[model samples]
Target: MRRYGIQPVASITDDLDIAPLLITSVGRLLWRYRSELAPVTMLALLIGTGTILHSSYRLWWPTVAGITALVAGVLLYAGRWVNLTRPIERAYAATATAFAGGWLTTSTAHGPFTKPLPLVLAIGCVVLAAPWWAHRRRRARVRVERTLAAWPDIAQAAGLAGSRVQSAIVDLWGYRFRLGLGLGQTVEDAVAAVPRLESALGSTRGGVRVQPVASKKANRADVRVIETDPHANAITWPGPSITFITQPAKLGLFEDGAPVRVPLLRRHGLFGGVSGAGKSGGVNVLLGELTACPDVILWGIDLKRGMELQPWASCIDRLATTPQEAEALLRDAVIVLDGRADDLAQRGKRVWDPSPARPALVIIIDEYAELASEAPQAIDHADSIARRGRAVAVQLVAATQRPSKDAMGKSAVRSQMDIRVCFRVREARDADLILGQGMVKTGWHAHKLDAPGKFLISSPDHDIPRRARTYLLDDHGVHTTTERHSTHRPSLDAVSVQALERAAEMPITEDAPPPSREAEKVLMAALRQAPAEGVRINDLMRATRMRRTWVYQRLQDLARTQQAEQVSRGFWRATPEKHAQ
Candidate 1:
């Protein structure tokens, strides 16, 4: 038994010869824990450098100190480039570098392990290692490495057998990996296998996401796994993000905390979401911004008896509560539109440039479906404005519970919207209805939004399907913002005011009333000078500074008195007897 197994060693060697193997194993173990052993390695390197410098080039210690000072200075401002993202991280890096460099410089001039120097090095190493070992991002990176090491098997089980991870980034909310798909494989395949991949990676349902790399290619995908959700809580609205109508309206925030800003200038917007999905909250945020702009004049149609837009009534120039009033408001807006258009044409300008004197007009319609059902006529004018208003700085911002074709019927008003914000919807098809056709298939799954303010936007500049949330301006906040900005609000310019006055002075129908002495005189003069054939109602109205109804009433009186006569349908002329006068 004593002679058995070749004394537990190779046949040509004794057991003592196994020392080399043991040493090699220990070296590999140390290398495996290199990050944890960093402080010790640094200390040894400092000692070695000091020993060599003291023996050969101790005079270079001052130069070492100067070089260390310069490096620390560079790291102060440029540390972000090296992944020292936070100020504290930069401070720690600079401090560590300075301490190590200073110790080496002092040790080089004296002895390698003099007096309190060794003790200081030991204490400093422990202190620095504490932060390094407990860093959240560092731990995330290590976990990512371990997870990636098992990715080959995970990929095989998840139906992506040959794909390989090209790169990865660990962020605050989650980690993402850039994948290189196998030949003949596609991003669709990866997307289809998302559930399987989530299970294989030990992530929750809906935790795994796959997006195609924005290229003309289908073989690359970016897989994101959410370990934490950044948008789980309500983001408090930071006051007015912009003070002018020309700036983008800062809405809420994206998942990465970037502001969701969509320009409101000269753009018609639609916000659609179910009840309690924060559609009103979204409108409140918009009102907060529009009220702050002196170059913007706001009008609102709150068909819910002004329940929704009442708090900001102070800032709104006109608020329509009933369907009749809504229709009249839109009609007046058309008059303003015509005036602005004619003005621009005369000046040879293609667009209405907004300013304090020539402010832009923004009409906010809450529960637009009610407007469609109650004031159907208003929809026609709204459609006209939507089609032609962008150039003249007259735009609509309508919010509705559902934007179904029936709810937004006849006008195709939904089609003209330039910016769309969609909140939580009831069905997969509803997302398409609110955003556009096939939006759910394209990854704008508004039905999946978990919170009230969460939404998805589709705009000219943002064509991709990224989820967002609208800023929540509560009742108190709304009142405060409106009151603060009320004094700075701009009035309607002269052109717009005259256009509205011309409309207001007009009678509703020819049968309503008789004109005053001066009004009657103006009408009689217009009829007496009418063209031989006839003068159109519009022409007579414009010539007499009256409305269509007013012109008709005066013409009717003139005809009855033999001072005017109808030459044809919708045409009028002065009679021979009247010409004699």
Candidate 2:
């Protein structure tokens, strides 16, 4: 009897040890596949809830149905509040809720164990769970969660141990996280570890980006993992983004699929990249947007005999194809700038408010390096426009293969460009020439951009470095767009036109003042005797024995006082009554 008892007790003790091991194994599996098992767990919960309600509150099925309907309706109509932004996600949520509630309501009335009810619940759960398990975004979210959960190990493998993920978000392209660094760690440290991080996370080369947080926190960095490349192809132009110059122009798209809208109303922009880097494509996209604006008069200087800008000549108010023409265009732009500044001063306004009758001037210079070297005299005027053009809505958009000090000229033009776009540069230091000093070290890695049209923009709206791609406007696109927008193009404002006319009439000598005696009398007499076509500004300068500046200023004053008027650009005439006087 003792031998038999000892054998049975030993077998029971072995079984007890195996039971604990089995429970531990199951718990590990449930934790390992928590995201994947969510739907199964939810179904189990629903079954238990239905059974409990059927036992105690069978009569409350109608209330449960009504509440379920209300909740499903909210989920269908307003699921964005719950972070369900996609239409399919909202629909799935609503359908899942309806299925769960309908099962609960029926089970509460008929009992959860009733013959086909259990079978029906199982079928419905499978049907709904299929979509939940197959959802791409959901899978991505789960993957991001698991990766973040393992970030400590990943960071350690990448020589960045103790770095913690503060917050994370998953989007269509990829995921981004705010990382809190350990003591003595910096964003540069994280940037330098990008390759290691990509390897640690099993990502492809150049798949991870480390940027400094917008808050400028010393110990924080924004890390982006590019699971899907958004700028893999050239984005086609979607036509003009704005009809007025005041609104921001949609230049391209960011990696997160957001529009790269930068306001060009009163800002100078610089575009720098190597040849064949799609700098021209970016310029074309910008012109497509700016040309559509009725309150912007477009002027272009393409020193390569208009090779780059000739396609949009129908829309550009002035297209300079020669070095002489380029120099003249920039000189006239400065004259217009001075004229608008004076007008704003007289009106007691701090800025020029552009309108159809008073349009803003946007000068686009393609191959700016050529202009700098070929027409060096124009750099001073370009510098002046860059310095003071913003207030009066005179903007300069300069595009160059390389914006070196020698290529951009020794001027403030590069420094004053508030919106800087660096495309696929040949060297890292070239980014600093285009984007500003110390930009390369700060993670503005324009040199790493591999594809044409891929760029990094730095502006008041976009201070952080994010990869973006410019819209493609091929030759056909440029032709169609220019033809569509040419009819809507506004002529230069009277102030700018008159200023250009005076500049055209100026003598070779610079800043020469008018004769002190009989200048006003001679100008009035010339206007009275002027042909019906009206007197040219050159003729007026000759008649008054005055400088072009003096003649233009007096004419503007007389026209304002209703004593004189412009017959055409650079042409003026006196009123009939004033001539009689």
Clashing pairs for predicted structure model 2, backbone only? none
Report the number of the highest-lDDT candidate: 2
lDDT string for model 2 (1-581, tens) is: 76667543444554466878899999988987887999899989999999999999999999999999999999999999998999889999999999899999999998999989989988988998899899888899888888888988998999899899999998888989999998899998998899899999888888999998889899999999898899988899989989898899999998988999998878899999999998999999999998888898888899888788878877887677878767767887888999888888888999999999999899999988998889999998998899899999999999998898899896588889989999999899899889988988878999999899999999999988899999999988998997788777776688876766666455656444535547788888888888877887757866766655566668877988989987654568998787777
Tens-digit lDDT string for candidate 1 (1-581): 45664555446546467789899999978866776777789888888888999899989999999999988877877898987888998998899989888988888898778888889888988998899899898788878877987889999999999999999988888888999998889877787788899899998877777777767367888888888877777877789888888999898887766889888888999999889999988888888888889899998899999899877776887778889768878988888899899999999999999999999999999999999999988989998999999999999999998898778865478988989999999888988888888767756678888789998899986776666777767777877887698778887787887676566565655733444677767666777777787776647655665544356556656777888897754568889785896
Model 2 accuracy (lDDT, Cα): 0.87
Candidate 1 Cα errors over 4 Å, as ranges: 1-33, 51-57, 184-188, 212-218, 505-507, 510-581
**Hey, what RMSD does candidate 1 come out at?**
11.1
TM-score of each: 0.81, 0.84
